[model samples]
Target: MTVIVQPTGVSAADVIAVARGDAQVEISPAAVEAMATSRAIVDGIEASGRPVYGVSTGFGALANTSIAPERRAELQHALIRSHAAGIGAPMPREVVRAMMLLRVRSLALGRSGVRPVLAQGLVDLLNHDLTPWVPEHGSLGASGDLAPLAHCAIVLLGEGWVLGKDGSRLSAAEALRTAGLQPLELAAKEGLALINGTDGMLGMLLLAIADASHLFAMADVTTALAIEAMLGSERPFLPELHSIRPHPGQAASAANIHRLLQDSAIMDSHRDDLAHAVQDAYSMRCAPQVAGAARDTLDFVSVVAGRELVSVVDNPVVLPDGRVESTGNFHGAPLGFAADYLAIAASEVGAIAERRVDRLLDVTRSRDLPPFLSPDAGVNSGLMIAQYTAAGIVAENRRLASPASVDSLPTSGMQEDHVSMGWAAAKKLRIVLDNLTSLLAVELLSAVRGLQLRAPLAPSPAGRAAVAAVTPFAGGPGPDVFLAPVLESARAVVSGPELRAAIEEAVGQLR
Candidate 1:
């Protein structure tokens, strides 16, 4: 697939296609023209000998220093080299690709005053599947992921490391040579434009939104199976119950769980027992409320991602009126706050899911289900340890949910006094979502086992399909086997697309 990068902006879908899939990226003709127009403005400024913040002068704390005309290109090169000081492990290939793609998108918008060749250089890297070796650390998230983007920018100059298509690390110059491309010379303002943006944090946020969206749907599916396994009432998921509150997410989640519970044989077997089953505990009944709130938070995060997709986040932006002015649009507070907010919401989703797992494994709370869903209770040990794992993950997620955006430290001689720890937020949010996936997987394993112990009673079609999907992971209602493999297998299934597709096939797409 080829994703055309436009001068106006790209969509979240475009970002995903190029970032996650093997989609090639192309700069639209209009974008090239826009870059040309902006390039002319920059050239004029250079000719006029104006001391622009990034063009003829030094950057950050050294903004007051002026550079001679002959030394301007050197200044740009030096900026990329000196700033490429990131530490720690290399960022994932997908993250580097996404950051590279977004940098091109920003530069091609004609606001950063870079030549068409500069943007094309980044596009070439993506088209050839060459990912720059951006390190995991060194971004404070304000002044826009400087060190991280600097590492990416240096690759365009053919002076850094790049991971080749085969995941082999090669020098950027060698990679560019093999791909029949040449290193781009850093032009005035071009190097700063390349490195000064929220691409790193923003890319991570976009990917998280995509992953979180799927997990949210999976959370709904898991909630349905858990309810059925617990022999809980489906009345709480009724459309009428959510109508008065009318949070779109709550309604959607309630509707999805309600649909999954339709014609449930397990639920029907105890339909007349409602008088005795007054409530099924908050974990079972409030699934939608918790997961629904998380869904809504994800929606808001998506909205933020959409806005950032179109934002021209750079310092010293070139205006249509032919004026060059510095701006603070590069600040990452928006992305940081969004990432943290989603983390908190996602943490709660995992928290509630763990609670459900606890309920399913508890002898007292599991209705009449065998202890730990094991046929041979004491000898089997069953899924008892799975709940402990979920609890541990939930606890870690709680710690990870402590918003990274709130803390700030001064940098660049305090010129960057209050930085947005957005990159940290995005990074931790990724971890939280991953933990949430495993946490939910444990819940899924326990619930499916509980459904297995329910036996001849049968489950809803969706529940039955879910159980069938996970059956490959382990045996049904048996004495404990090597559970690590079982839990790992369940995690694989939960993290993949097959389980979701199977359930949606039986019950239609989840909300």
Candidate 2:
């Protein structure tokens, strides 16, 4: 699939397509014309010798320094070269691709006053799968991911490094030549436009939102499995129980759990045992409330990401009337706040999941289930260490959930004081989500094992499907045999589409 960059904006779906799907990209004719129009205005301003911020003067704390016409081109080159000072390991391929695509999207809006060819340079890189070697560190997220974006921009000028189509690292110059493309020569305001935006953090936020959305649905699925495995009542998920509070996500989650446990033989077994089944633990009973709150956080984060998609995040934006004015559109506060909030929400979900995993392993709390769900107690440590792993991950998630946006430090000689730290927020959020995936995987596997222990009484279709999906890799109930591989396999199944497909096949579509 090809995503056409419009002057208006690109959709979040398109961003994901190009970022993760390796979809082709193109600049629309309207966007090209817009770039040309904006370029002409920049040319006029340069000819007028008005000493514009980026066009005629230096950047950041050096904004007061004036430059002669002969040195302006050198100034732009020096800007990219000096700012491309990011240090640390190279970022992931998908993240680099998203940053490149987003930068092109901002340039295509024609608000940054770059010629059409500059935007085309980025598009060509995306199309050729030549991702710039952006580092993990750098960017206070106030100057709009300057260092990381500069690493990307330097590749446009063929001075930095890039990951080639085959995943081989190569100099940007060699990679461009191999891809049959020429290096870009920046004109006035082009260099500054390239690096001055919230593209990096925004891109991460967009990808995080997409991942969190999927994980939220998967959370509901796993929560239902845990409820059934523990022989917990589905009465808590009744529609009447949630209609009073009426959080859309809460209602949807309750409905999903209710539907998943519809024909459960285990549920039926305890249907009349109101005395013993009067209530389950908070982790089992309040599943919807916690998962639902995470869902609500995702919705709010999506709204912020949606707005960022349409935003032109360059400094000194060009107006329709041809005036270039400096602005704070590059600030990453919005994205930082959203990413941090989602991390907290995801952490709580994983925390509750870990608690459920603990409950399933405890002989006292798990009803008739064996200790750690072992066939022979004290001989096999069946899933005993799994809860420890989940607990450790949840602890790490709690630490990572600390909001990076709330902390700031001065940069650019205090010209960029009070930065957003949004890049840190995004980076930690990515780790948090990855940890959550593994944490949920543990809960899913343990719960499935618990359900299997309830012999003769089969799980609901959805629950059985989940068990079947993991059985191939994780195997059925048995003595512990290299438990790490089983947990890893379960993690893959939980994070992949196969489990979702299997579950949905058994019980229509999930919420």
Q: What is the C-alpha RMSD of each candidate to the true structure, in Å?
A: 1.2, 1.1
lDDT of 1 by residue, 1-511 (tens): 8999899978888889999996999999999999999999999999999789999999999999999999999999999999999988788898988999999899989898988999888888899878898889999998999999999889888898987656667898988899898888988998899999999999999999999999988898888889899988889999999999989999999999999988777888888974548877998889899889999999999999999999989999999888999899999999999999999999999999999888888889888888888888886788888888888999999999999999999999988999999999999999999998898888888889888888898888888887887887687877678888888888888889998888788888888
Score every model by TM-score: 0.98, 0.98
Candidate 2: list runs displaced more than 4 Å. Answer: 164-168
- How far is 225's C-alpha from truth in model 1 (Å)? 0.5
Per-residue alpha-carbon lDDT of model 2 for 1-511, expressed as tens digits?
Answer: 9999999979999989999999999999999999899989999999999989999999999999998888888899999999999888888888988998899999999898999999999999899888899888888898789999999999989889996556566899988898899988888888999999999998898889988888888888888888888888899999999999999899888888899998889889888885666888999999999999999999999999999989989989888798999999999999999999999999999999999999999999988899998989788999999899999999999999999999999988989888899999999999999999999999889988988889789899988888787778777788788888888888888778988887788788888
Candidate 2, pairs of clashing residues: none
User: What is the Cα root-mean-square deviation between model 1 and the actual structure?
Assistant: 1.2
* Cα lDDT for residue 412, candidate 1: 92
Q: lDDT of each prediction vs. the true structure? A: 0.90, 0.90
**Clashes per candidate, residues 3 or more apart or on different chains:** 0, 0
lDDT of 1 at 190: 89
